[model samples]
Target: MMETSKGNTSPLKVQLVYTTNIQDPNVYSEVQEQRESPAPPKTSAAAQLDELMAHLSEMQATVAVKADISKRHLPDKQDHEASLDSMLGGLEQELQDLGIATVPKGHCASCRKPIAGKMIHALGQSWHPEHFVCTHCKEEIGPSPFFERSGLAYCPKDYHQLFSPRCAYCAAPILDKVLTAMNQTWHPEHFFCSHCGEVFGEEGFHEKDKKPYCRKDFLAMFSPKCGGCNLPVLENYLSAMDNVWHPECFVCGDCFSSFSTGSFFELDGRPFCELHYHHRRGTLCYGCGQPITGRCISAMGHRFHPEHFVCAFCLTQLSKGIFREQNDKTYCQSCFNKLFSL
Candidate 1:
């Protein structure tokens, strides 16, 4: 007879031993012994054995249930006889006949629950059909295209609104190729002149007032106008009279000649050479009928060259403020008193 010890136990204990018959090993007899303890047995040995057997049966049933569930979760083995389609068609029904339920193939990415029915595979994860929804709108994304950002799924409309670059002109999302200029974004077709609305070419564009423009419109609308030609002064321009003029356009308004001496006089908001400027304002000498560019004498209501101011009677040259006037003519003081001493 072989005896086995059950490690450690409480002070009060009942030891149960079962020995197999030598002739028939399957037949067994039970021997019960009560050890020295502070407490007596509460019930008979037969009743305690019955309770233990019932508990063992319950544990065994629980283990069987868990094993069945594990078996159903395992990956399916390759079927040599039937194709995949046939096996899938009858597999659920066959399991149901065996009183076993079908298990979920995957868990939903959104709700983190088993996907027993239709499943949506998106963004490298599986999801229940109803649970696969846009993060912003919370609307279902079943069978439709989606966008992914920051490990989250979104519908097409929300994705474009939230993430796509917007056109600076139209204020709409730039779904296609983007043209970035003027520190803003725009669609390729919408990146045009703000004034003319004509599209820009590879020559590039200009910016003004926080908007973009083609070369033609930019110069026409923003560049200063030439003072002479009254047209846009694109380059090589000069600023005069608070206006800009191209080098070729800066000419005399009257004679249409350029200032050879790099100097000009202004008349009525226009530039002119010294000769034409004096003539325009009637500042020329009455004797020579030429522009008096230097100091001149005013007598008889007409400007005169210094030597041209002479006496009407003796033809003597007169000094300024010492000359006398009579009958709209100029004369010296001595000649005036000699001719007509009144």
Candidate 2:
């Protein structure tokens, strides 16, 4: 009546050998002869039980006949007759008890036949020693570990082959630990960076093309290069002028200094500080030789700040495009007409 758990794979050992009383007169002599001449090991316990049951059946009939004869012959011997009757009754009861106890415990779950000796107790059922077989191959799963799914037993090899999750990279069954990522299952060791072929650590990983990659390889292969430093931007980047730049890499083109005001001017698609941008564009004021950030006047083929553009004779501010150029010096209409009129 022993039951093994689903996880337990140890073989269930049941001793089916039954012993009879040696004090019985008829069986005592035969048992003595058996002890004197030992039987071979090849004689199975079931075979021995069958032989003993046959002998007991024969002895039961002989004792019945002997009791009948004693009842008729020893009617005058009361004391001896009572003792003999009690002994015969006790022996008969013992034999009946032995027959009941020797019956098989339960039917085999596989074959639906009574399991006699060495029954296997597994999956909350009894099975014959050879009947406890894998449901798939029908081969005996004797003593070895097995997997049970949906009330069916399977050997270790077949179970893993049929049901275990497969590794996405190696395409092999994952027997022990399974690592799941990117909608695929894998073995822990097989779940490595596709670029470097090394296992991922605490830094974790990145997914590209449905494969895992380390941070360094992923950035190098996929991340955009910085517009200033010309290196891959890992994170925290600025997007301007259709180019990406790492926060530290977004610097002025000439001075290589980061923008303090977070403002930049672009020339030929490159960012520069205000001073450098105006200098590069040749837009510096002619009078002050500095960049003109506000409105400026262009006269005498040179750009001049509005306040700096003056009439040469009157020293007053000349309007934009309303001055006369003479000797490479600018003058207003009235001043030019009055000073140089002939």
Candidate 3:
């Protein structure tokens, strides 16, 4: 019979039930003893499960710590890489400054061959100090004062000779200081006034006949003179009968009146008004026997008015179209044909 105690659980007894005995007896006994005893007060299944969960949590914590350490080292590794890159960049710039070209090494600009030793950096290329020579005069211009024009180097003296302005009067190069006027350049000592043989230095001048002249000489020598007043005709004047005269001095010879604006006749080298000239020197009209005041037609040593110089038979104007003259009498073609065609 099984015994039971009050409020106390009894140990379970496991019976060894065997079917076959092919194995060793000691092995079978050891297995039966392990099953029969109360497992020597072993921990419960739930406690063992809790212990396994704690071990799993500890392993997870260890893995998390390792991950955090790796994450902290990642930035340092990146910074180290960036520092290496910066160092490399600085080295490259230094190499460039030392004239070590980043591309394939090129030849010297002047010598047209591979550059070996010390080189100069100029004109967007490399060159040897001895090879980089001036284009003009063929002199070496290494680290010396020089000028560049049209992509070619030139020494100072040769550059000035090639580009400096030339004098207009002497036709010599203007080396130091220059005077510019009349759209030309001249040396300070070579610039002179045209009228007077005097040197002009920073003074006002005038140009005439493609020559420079001082103000006083230009006004006195080249200024026009009036024919009537015999004075300098500086500004507005009248030109008539091959003579220049002031506006106030232009007068009629016969009437002695000022002619503002009208037709004037020249007689005996004198200017006369229109009315007085017609009365004094105009020809007489043959038809009216009066002085011709306007245009007159002269034929056969006689002058006639334009309206009176017509066909006598037809009384038609003969100034235009064809006409015939008989016994000094003008006749139209129709009147002449009707009277004399037969």
TM-score of 3: 0.38
TM-scores of all predicted structures: 0.58, 0.59, 0.38
Q: Residue by residue across 103-190, what tens digits does model 3's lDDT show?
A: 3245888757554344555565666668777787888766565666776777778877898799988886777898888889988777
> What lDDT is reached at residue 21 by model 3?
19
lDDT of 3 at 296: 85
lDDT of 2 at 80: 55
| lDDT (tens digit, per residue) of candidate 2 on 289-318 | 889988887766688888888888897887
Which parts of model 3 are misplaced by more than 4 Å?
1-108, 112-120, 175-184, 187-192, 197-206, 251-342
Indicate the residue-level lDDT of 218 in model 1. 86
Show how many residue pairs clash in every candidate, following the order shown: 0, 0, 0
List clashing residue pairs in candidate 2: none
Residue-wise lDDT of candidate 1 within 1-342, one digit each (tens)?
A: 222122221221224333223221111222345466564565565455455446546755665565566556556554322333344445546434533345565787876765555556666667776887888999987756677787787888998999989988889998879988888898888877888889988888898878888899888888888887778877688888898888888899888899889999999998998888988888888777888877788866688777777787887877655887788777788888888787
Best by TM-score: 2
